[model samples]
Target: MEDGKIKGKAMVLSGFDQEESAREALEQALKEAGLAREAIGIIVTTGNGRKAISFAKGDVTEARAAALGAVFLYPTARTVIDVGAEESRAIKCDATGKVLDFAVNEKCAAGSGAFTEAMARALEVPLEELGPLSLRATQTIPMNAQCAVFAESEVISLIHSKTEKADIARAVHDGLSSRVVAMVRRVGLNTELVLIGGVAHNPGFVESFKRTVGLDDVRTAAEPDFVGAIGAALAAAE
Candidate 1:
């Protein structure tokens, strides 16, 4: 994911059904990144043969990796918010991204990058245009749906009403922010609130987040999207 300011990459070798293939993919990525091939870290999930692993050169991963590593470093961080492509997560962790308490909204696309992508498509715009376009809105149109289907309908209505596309975009950002902020509160708004995952790239979303949560400090890695991979790598380092 590219946030204009930061970029991250993650390769999940899911559906492999074999540890060997998974291991090969992991090794290849590490070698390509110029990381030591001997360095391996492992994390076992609830599913069989579905392991999350990481490889790096040092005692820990890189700085982006360290932000995720920080979660494992702190056993008391009860909340982790990860906003990504298909869904957004409010995870309660034990100082590690090892989810202890977690809530996710995957049933709908309203709060995910997918929703933003769809909107951008409907507006005949590119994803890179969203941030600057949203910043141009003189006023935010009200969008009241948490489900993507309903939100799409609302957006169409706005288009019919001749609402400025910028206003509509800002409204989408507002709606998503409200839902995610509620998720954070539901998971118990603790300090060290780490905001990771892909959607963290949206400047409007970030600004709306700061406003909605009344949080003076929000933590985001240089590469927000790859925090999970980085976390997996960090766990393996341990």
Candidate 2:
């Protein structure tokens, strides 16, 4: 995209093994885009695996990627909350997408997507069901554990007590939302907040997140999963 708009995009998860798989997936994406390696002028990578992406010319920090990507997707975006598999980030940025400040929570899975995955498994529901199930919750149930491992046990207890799955699901979303919002507040959350990352696909989490943060509206991309790569692509274009 150095002198052009994005012509193609693709994604394939390797489940944290290494960069080789990601590279293979990239090659596939490039193939789908009808381009060859020699057609590209530069390459940039981002995220934890960035250091291992041997073919890349350089890298960008995940915070910068998320911030810039949010602004690119939504120009009005002033704050971005990025939630990945193992961690979460809150980024404050200016109108031009320059990161002003940011905060992160990586000490535990409490605020991460892993937290929801674990609870979903415990509930014996498809992971995709968590959001909708929570939405149907007729009563509020607060979760007590911030540690995902311990929280899994608490979920079991809720099950043994015959608590409605919907209520339990909402409780789980509530717990994760609180932790994510804490990071957002630390970064001085303002109007035009955008939520990105794989977890953002969950409507339940989105609603819970907005309500917990006392916001009436939030922004998101149509296909947010590629925001980081898009940012890296933007860097390469520069």
Candidate 3:
């Protein structure tokens, strides 16, 4: 986290029963950035797993960190739509990278990445392939379920109906985008929209977001997942 840039990063997937994947990511980022643990100055943490890392000097909110991180990387960024594994949020930012307004969907699982994972499992398709496969669909399929549990059942029904997995995948992403779109609309769409978090890796979701929100030109950090970490580092530098 020197010079406002992540040095190295590592990740320990949930399968390992690890909460602070950043512990490994931090070591890797430091090594990648070419710094030793002792050489580091101060430690700052943010995001859902902040409490799991006992070594942090301080912590910041995800919206604050994400705003700063996106602005730091893309100077023109004004809004950030962060879709995480279990929750999603939309943040409106000003020129100075200060968050002006925000909306979060933490109560529901249907709008999060976990929903897509569940659908993929129901369709007997690999989770990683959901996004690309969804992109292959020629016609949009409507998904009515508003809950992940029901959505999972819906996906199973789609599979039983012999519906193309691609259409089902697209519908899943569209459902997520619809939820996120509601949040973004609440804050109002500003230029230089940015999408962050693990779900941004889903290309299908990205396109669905653009279409549903009616805004393309969405910006993303080079290391999208680390935007929050980058913002925390910038705060630490300050």
RMSD of each: 6.9, 1.2, 1.8
**Collision count of model 3:** 8
Predicted candidate 1 versus true structure: per-residue lDDT over 1-238, tens digit per residue: 1112112233553554555555665556656655554432333221123333332223332223323543753444456777777777776666445555566666578767788877777766788788678878899667877777777788888889999999988887788888888877766777767777778888767766776788776766556755665554544444
Which candidate, 2 or 3, would have the higher lDDT against the true structure?
A: 2
RMSD of 3: 1.8
What stretches of model 3 exceed 4 Å from their correct place?
14-20
**lDDT accuracy of residue 36 in candidate 3:** 83
lDDT of 1 at 142: 76
lDDT of 3 at 212: 89
lDDT of each: 0.63, 0.87, 0.83
List the candidates' TM-scores in order: 0.71, 0.96, 0.93
lDDT of 2 by residue, 99-175 (tens): 99999988688889999999999999998999999999999888888899999999999999999999999999999
Q: What value does the lDDT take at residue 175 in candidate 3?
A: 94
lDDT of 2 at 40: 82
lDDT by residue for model 3 (162-218), tens: 898889899999998999899888998886788998999988888898888786566
Q: Candidate 1, TM-score vs. the true structure?
A: 0.71
- Residue 76, model 3: lDDT of 84
**Candidate 3, after superposition: displacement of residue 237 in Å?**
0.8
